[model samples]
Target: MAAIPKSTGMQGGAMAEEAADELTLLAERHLVQPWPMSGSIGAEARGRIEGGEGIYVTDAAGRRLIDGPAGMWCVNAGHRRRELAEVMAAQAMELSYNSPWYTTNAPAALLSGRLAGHAPDGLDHVFYTTGGSSAVETALRFMQFANNVKGRGEKKLIVSRQGAYHGSTYLSASLNGRPRDQDWMDGAGEQVVKLTCPNPFRRPEGVAAVAFCDYLVAEFKDVIETVGAERIGAFVAEPVMASGGVIVPPDGYLRRIRELCRQNDILFIADEVVTAFGRLGHVFASQEVFGLDPDMITFAKGVTSGYFPLGGVMIAGRLLEELRRSNHSEAMFAHGLTYSSHPVGCAVALKNLDLLEDGLLEHARSISGHFQSSLKALEELPLVGEVRGMGLMACVECVADRVSNNPLTLDLEVGKRIDNHCQELGLLVRPLINMCVMSPPLTISTSQIDDMAAILRRGIELTMDDLVREGLWRG
Candidate 1:
C-alpha cells in the first residue's frame, strides 16, 4: 500500500478548494443523516473518511485516527483488504444482481454453506438481508411466520430487553428498548415486551450481584406467565449488548434464559450484528461465549468486514423441520429484500471470513486480555465509573461520582466531550451519552491497544478538566 498522504485535500493546493466546497454543499443540501435526526450537513456529520487501512482511517483532510468503534462495530478484518476488494470486483463483474426471490446466486450458496460451518450446532440455514436491522427484521418476521403457519398466530410477541437496540426497521425497532431510538419515531411497540437489561453496573444500587441475577430471572419468569408462554414467539438478545454500552451479563444469565426458552418452546434469537464474525474472536459468540444454543442468530456488520453491506439470520435445522411438518405447508414466509442474497456482498464476506479464519480470530483472542486489562485500568480514573467488556469490545462509562455511578447529565454530553478531545488526539470513539463504546477492529495489535488506551485516558482526563472548570464536577 502506498504511504497515506498527510493531507490529500490540500495536495491539490488552491485548486481543490472548489471541489471541497462542492462536496460540502451537496452533503449539506441533499444527503440525509440517520440516528441523530439532525440536518444533513451539520457538526453531526462526523467527517468524510477518504481511505482506511489496518484500523486507521484518513479523513478528507488526511488526518488519521484510530477507528475505535470499528466502523459501527463492523470491519473485523480491518480496512482496505486487497483480497476482499478483488473478490468484490470479480464477483460484481461475474454476477452482480439476481432477483433473490426466484433465483439464488452462486456466491450466496457458497457463503451460506461456509457460514453454516461457523454457526452454532444446528443453525445451518441462512436468510440474507441488506444489514443488521434487516437481518433482525427477517428473523422477527420468520418467528411470526413460523408461529402463524403452526396455527398459533396469537404467539407473535417478541421479548427483548431494556437498553437493547435490535434495529431501525419498524418491526425490529419495536424490540429496541433504547430511549433515544424510540423518540421522534414510530415502532410496532405493541408486539414487543422489554425486560430490564442485565447490566450489573447499572442495576439497582441496593441489590447484590447475585440478587440482581435472581431478580432478572424472576422478572423473565413473571413476564412469561403474564404474557402466557404460548402467546410469545421468541426471546431476542445480544450476547453482549453491543450498542447498549457493551453490557456483559453476569455468568449463568444466558444459560438460564436458554433453559426458559427451551422449556416454553420459545425461540432464542441471538443478535450478533456487532459480536459475531471475529469481533469477539469467534464467528458466533452466542454459543462460544454465552454457552447458549440460539435457535436463530442474526448477524451483519462484520460479515463482510464493512466492505459491502450484508447480513443474515441463521436458522436452526429444527425450525425448518417444524415448518415443513406444519399443516399449512402452502403458506410461504413471504419476506425478502431486494438485496437479500447480494452476490457481491457474499463474495466480499467470503474473503473477509477467509482472513478471519486464517489468523485474525486467533490474533483477536490473543490480544483480547490485553485489550480488556488496558481499558479496565481506566477505572482508576475518577471519571470512569466502570470498564466492562470481553474480547476486543468494551466501554468506558463516565459518571459524576465513581462510587454511586451517578450519571452525568445528558446535557453535558460527556461522551461527546471526551470524543472531541480523543479525535484531536488522533482517535475516534462512539459516544453514547456518557458512555464511550469501544470495539476496535480485530486486527488491532497490543501496541495499538496501548496507544488507543492512552489517547482515551487523556481524552477522559481532558473531559474531567472541562467539567471541573465549568463547575459541573468535583471528582
Candidate 2:
C-alpha cells in the first residue's frame, strides 16, 4: 500500500499549485470540515479534484479512482455530463434568480411539473429548497402548518426510527437516530420519538416476523396515544435505510407502518434523500419498493446527480389544498430561502431528470439483480456476517461471532482495515457503524461492476486472513 504523506504533497506542478490555493482558502475560512479523513491521509491528500468524467474522479495527484460511492450517493447521472452543464450555463445566462412566490421561472415550474408526473399520486405539489436538510425542515414545518390549517393545532410530535438518518438541520438531525448526531441536542429528543429499526438481522430472540411488525405498530400507537393522536403531527422515515448501515426491512414492514400511520391519522413523511431517483431501482423508493404513499416526500442528491444543490418536498393533494386555502400574505407559510429554487440549480435538475427518464431509471432496475447477486458472494468470507441491501445500495456487515450473530462493534477495527485495503486497491467505500457500504454511480458499466466486486472481494478475503492470523477466526 502507498503510504499517505504529511503536509502539501507534490504531484503535477499546476495541479499542486491549485490544490495549495484551495487548502490555504479552506484554512482561511476555518472550514476544517466534518467527516475529515484520517490525519496522515488528510494532511498529505491532494486538496482538489480537477475534473471528473463518467464514473471516475481525477484528483490533483493525477490519480483516478472509480467513484464507488457515487460522490456521497448523489451522482446517479454520473459526473461531467456536457448536456447538464450546458443547461446550467444557459439558465445562468438567461435568468439566474427568481422568487417562486411571486415571479416564477421556467426551470422551476417546468421541473416541478415533470416531477409531478413521476411522483406518487396526489403528491403533485412541489416546494423547493437548497438541499436535503432544508427539504426535511420544509416537510416538518409543512406538517405543523397543515395540522393547524385543518383545525388540529395540537399535532406537533414526530415519530422516527432508530438507525435512520435524515439530514443535518435541526429537525432533520433530530429525526436521525445516530447517537453521535443527537449528542448535542435536547429539544430534538423531546419533540421526536424514535422506534427500533425494523432490521430482521438485529432483532431480539424469538422475534417472529409477524410479531416484529406488531411491535413496531404498537410502539408508534403508544407514542401517538401518549402524545395524543390529535396532537401528534407526522411520522418520518427513510423508505430504504441509508446512513444506518443500509438496512433493508423485512417484507410487510413498510406496509404495516403505513397502515398504522393511516389508522392513527398521522401523516407519513418519506425521507428519500438517499433512496430517491435511481438508487433503489425506483423513481421513489416509497412507491416502487414499499408501496408506501406518504403525505410528504423529501428528496435531494440524485435529483441533479450532485451536479448542483437542489431538493424539495412533494406535498400530497390534501395537504396542498389545505395550504392553498390558508394563504394570507401576512399569515401564509412564509418559510423560504434566498436560494430556494435557484434557476441554475433547477435547470441542471431538469436536464438531469430528463437524462434519468430517458435511460438511467430503467438502467438501474435492469442491473440491480445482477449487482445484488454479485455482492452476496461476500457472504462466503469468514468475517462477513451478512450481505443485504437493495438496488445499487448495499452493505457487508462484519461480525465477531457468526453463529451467535454478534455484531462487531466499531472498536473491533476489522471494518476500518477492510475499508483501507479497498481504498489502496483503488476503490472508495464508507464503513458505517459495523459494515462497509457501496453505492456506485448508475452509469457504471458491467465491466466496472465486475471491477467493483473484485476489489471488494479482495478486501473481504484480506480481512478474513488477518482475523485468522490474529487467532480471531477458527475457519
Give all TM-scores, in the order shown. 0.95, 0.89
lDDT, candidate 2, equals 0.81
Candidate 2 per-residue lDDT over residues 1-475, each given as its tens digit: 2222344666778766765676655544444545554453334432456678898887655667678788889999888899988988898899988876677788888988998888988999888998899999999998887776666777888888888888888778888886466665554777887888878788768888668777777777777677788777888988878888888887787888888789888888999989998998777888877888998899999999998999999999886666667644245676988888788998998888888889888899888988888889889876678899899999888775555455345324777877777877867767775588889999887788888889988987887787778877665
Give all candidate RMSDs, comma-separated.
Answer: 3.8, 4.5
Q: Note the clash tally of each candidate.
A: 0, 1
lDDT scores of the candidates, listed in order = 0.88, 0.81
The ten-residue window of minimal lDDT in model 1 covers 1-10
Candidate 1's displacement at residue 285, Å, is 0.9
Q: By TM-score, who's the top model here?
A: 1
Tens digits of per-residue lDDT for model 1, 1-475: 2233334355465656656655655566555667544543343444687889989998767689999999899978888888999999999899899998889988899999999999889999999999999999999899888888888989998999999988888898898887567877788888889999999998977889878888888999999999899999999999899888899998898999989999999999999999999888899998888788999999999999998999999999999998888788799888889999999999898888889899999999999999999999999998888999999999998886444454446424787899999988999989888889899999998999999999999999998899889887786
Model 2 residue 311 CA deviation in Å: 0.2
